[model samples]
Target: MRNGGCCPKLDPLPGEEESAVRTSHWRKELERRRDSVERETDGSNMKTATRKKDGEKEVRAMAPLAPQLCSRLAQKAMMRSSVTKSMASRDRVRFNVGGQLFETTSTTLANAGRDSMLGALLDDSWNPGQPEYFLDRNPACFSVLLDLLRTGALHIPANVPQKLLYREALYYGLLDHVRNAKWGPFDGNRLRLADSVPGRAPGDGTAIRAAPDGGCCVAHGSVVHVYNWMLEERRPISLDYQQVNDVGYIDADSIVITARERLGRAEGGMAVFSAATGELQHRFRVEHGQQPKSFTAGALSLAGPDDNRIFSSCKGRLNEYGIGMWDLNTGQQGDFFYELPGCSLGDADILQWLPSKNCLMVATLFPRTDNCFIGLLDFRAKTIPWSWSDAGIVVTLEDKRVLHAIAMEDGHSICVINQYEDLGFIDLRAGTGTNSAGTGVRWSSRSKLMNRKVPFEESCYPKLATHNGQLFSCMNDSISVFSGSEHVLTSTLSRSYGGSICDFSIGGDRLFALHNEDNVFDVWETSPSPII
Candidate 1:
């Protein structure tokens, strides 16, 4: 009758005597054979005939089985949340104190061996006798509430009784859900964590950049959270929710995003989400404890005709494992691409995909062996041989002819890449690269400090992009355009992105979008006549 390691909200731990008494309650479980034999022969009677025997052999009889012992052990392992149903009156009733709405009945399923502290609010007052939906029978409410607490959003069936009450479905994952099924326009904005004076998001007016097509993405949390920047009526509309570590535009409407979520108890790691709706379209979760900390998801290159045949880079734990393929259509491994005998992907490994040629480029990070190298893999080939990187941060110019890579002294660094507006001369077919060591295409930041020591351009790694033949990059609160090196600063200004920017996409029209990798982003465009 002691707490016996029960939930914190329940009875406390037992006294010394109770603890010691329970500790000695171990009993060897009935082996499968013995249990089977007992099932086959219930009574102690065994028939004996012939052999001059009076004929009756007694088998070992089962003792009066302690019923309370099995129940107690089961109680120790089973957990209860705020929503547990008790059979009140003749009808069975379910309870959910978390929602604060007693219903006719409900059923939830929680995972085993985990604790649900926030769900401890349910009690016995829930009753079904009055026709009020008090308690049904659900064990999963704990996980639902835990998810809400963690991500500030919860995905539930729309028909649930309390679904209407959820004007705000908050869950973890750095994204917010503003449910306005009522008549009103609702847009998903990135959740900003910096200073927000009450409901006013940080530099929201200054932040909030639109993508190339002219629409904005919701930004939130320590990391970047962009709803799939798909468009509607030339406006940015979220297709789904996606939390990605990094992203690259594969084509006009599709961009590959790397996403990961970490839940306690060995369930965590990276996945790939879609850029259209911000939804986790596909993911291969590597068990946190099962694999090495440095195991790669084989992102060195992604190629396919927009189907599910995806490949991953993995380590077998000892040395270089090999290249593995994933059949996205079925989420299974389709093929083993190749193997690097002693090579492996390090922390800053870079993977690039060139769709036109159906090839992939990979850069491996090893301390003293080789610099960044590029490799090409063909889905049609029998072997996937890796070509080392001459440099990291490889990118294509607007003209689609030239490729650019950042060159430094050491070999492990990957400078951020961004597309600056077409500010260079229209006379030149592509933009240019200028850094500390000219252009080695095989260098890194050996002794440079990222913040206080690295050069402005070296650390910032400015991108070059063109819109309407005008080259532009967001610099110091103004979108600066360049004609050759001659610059023209847009007098119109947006709020400052604290750090140098790296990523942006055309949200809609002339509305340019910009983000500082870690902070909230802002959208800017020249204004027409002030509309009423």
Candidate 2:
């Protein structure tokens, strides 16, 4: 044998023909062994090839992911989605909130919508390399928000402060979801009657008014009593020989009371009294003629730029009704008092007086009929600009139920409620055509109030009053408080009065409810929740 370069090259020695024969025999044996080895490793090689193909298939299958799929699942569960330990680090997210650690699917965080902080963080266009989020907020509160996002529901803890939770919700842009959670009826704990005062007379309270200076006036039987916010008696006027219809404040220190003499000379009149002292400041006698009238029809309202002029709806002659104006300072009557074209006022109630527009809202009921009329008396135009009767509104709706309406603070919209608990709005500004035939008034589609319970006939007649951009209505024993531009019920107060409410008034952030049975007056202070 001899070596040629690095490989060994066999050289035939002695006999060339014999060496060639031996080399051929060795080549044949080498081929046989090679074939045996290939056969032995066939199964192992096949498995290796199959595994490589499977790995490539998996990579192809996972190349694309749905943007919000992870979040949707977590939301449905009302909690964070759990990932396996074998999941890639990029698919999972860890959060450190106030020293608390939370593990969730990255897709779940992205489901908060692109506008939210979590969504922004998960957005690859903005946060390309983010793997974990650390929030400087209450972890417990964040958990609640997470559950809300996951479950489309909200569960607040007993120990948590709602204001603080609301703040967090706003910070995270979850206020809409949180506000929707509070959309149902109001809780009983929202509005609470804080004080009660027994009436001086044994008669039931007919009317109540909240004064400008945080005091209240109540008319029970033939007596009017004034009380401060603390329900302490300040003044009491015993009008045993008179029939009082309504009481209101002319100024912080003075109040105007409307009453009719019930004794020998049956005449209706308005008297001014000092709220500080129970002394009568002035008395303006009403002269409607002596015709032995069955019932009196008039409502007292103060107008003018300084709210010094008084406007009254009075029946001038038999079966004739008109609006009367009087100067409170000078006690002088206006030159002209306009009367509605063909309507007669039986029991007139002055709803509101807009000094800026110089308009007065009045609700009139016919003497012995189910007809109710609401009109706007524009002092600037010196006419009853617009009016609507129950019959006029009934033609517009399918359900012809008994309806009670109130003038909204906007001076254009009227809030109406019917016996069937249907709540709707009438647009006074949308009044079209001439006032000759009373053609124009638009009604909104009906909806229910905050009360989920079915309304009864007794509670159906909910009395509505507004204060500080909020509306208060006394329905049965509960007083509902609605506030905001949309007028959603923030809460309700349950009255402790033993009887049904005869009258209720909201003034100076105070709510007054009068019991129909024992003449007990319950007063509640408005504490509205913050708008979300």
Best by lDDT: 2
Cα misplacement distance, residue 256 of candidate 1 (Å): 6.6
* Stretches of candidate 1 exceeding 4 Å from the true structure: 1-224, 227-244, 247-266, 269-282, 285-327, 336-349, 364-370, 382-497, 506-518, 524-532
Task: Write one digit per residue (lDDT tens) for candidate 2, span 1-532.
Answer: 4556567766567798798999999999999999999987997799989999999898787767544667677676653233333245666678898989887766776657778777676565744346567889998889988877776667889987776787898889877666555333223335555568777677667788887655689887567888864456886876655777778888668888777645445455567888878798886643344323322334666663366677665553355356656678787555324455544433565456765346677776432345567777676576777676665444543444434557777776777655444455667767532333233334333333333554444432557766556766665666666678777667766655557776787665556787777768886653344546
Per-model TM-score on C-alpha atoms: 0.35, 0.55
lDDT score, residue 444, model 2? Answer: 30
lDDT (Cα, 0-100) at 197 in candidate 1: 16
lDDT of the candidates, in the order given:
0.36, 0.65
Candidate 1, residue 267: CA error in Å? Answer: 3.7
Model 1: per-residue lDDT, tens digit, 370-469? 3433344565684344343323333423211112222111222223222232221111112222222223232223213222232335223334334443
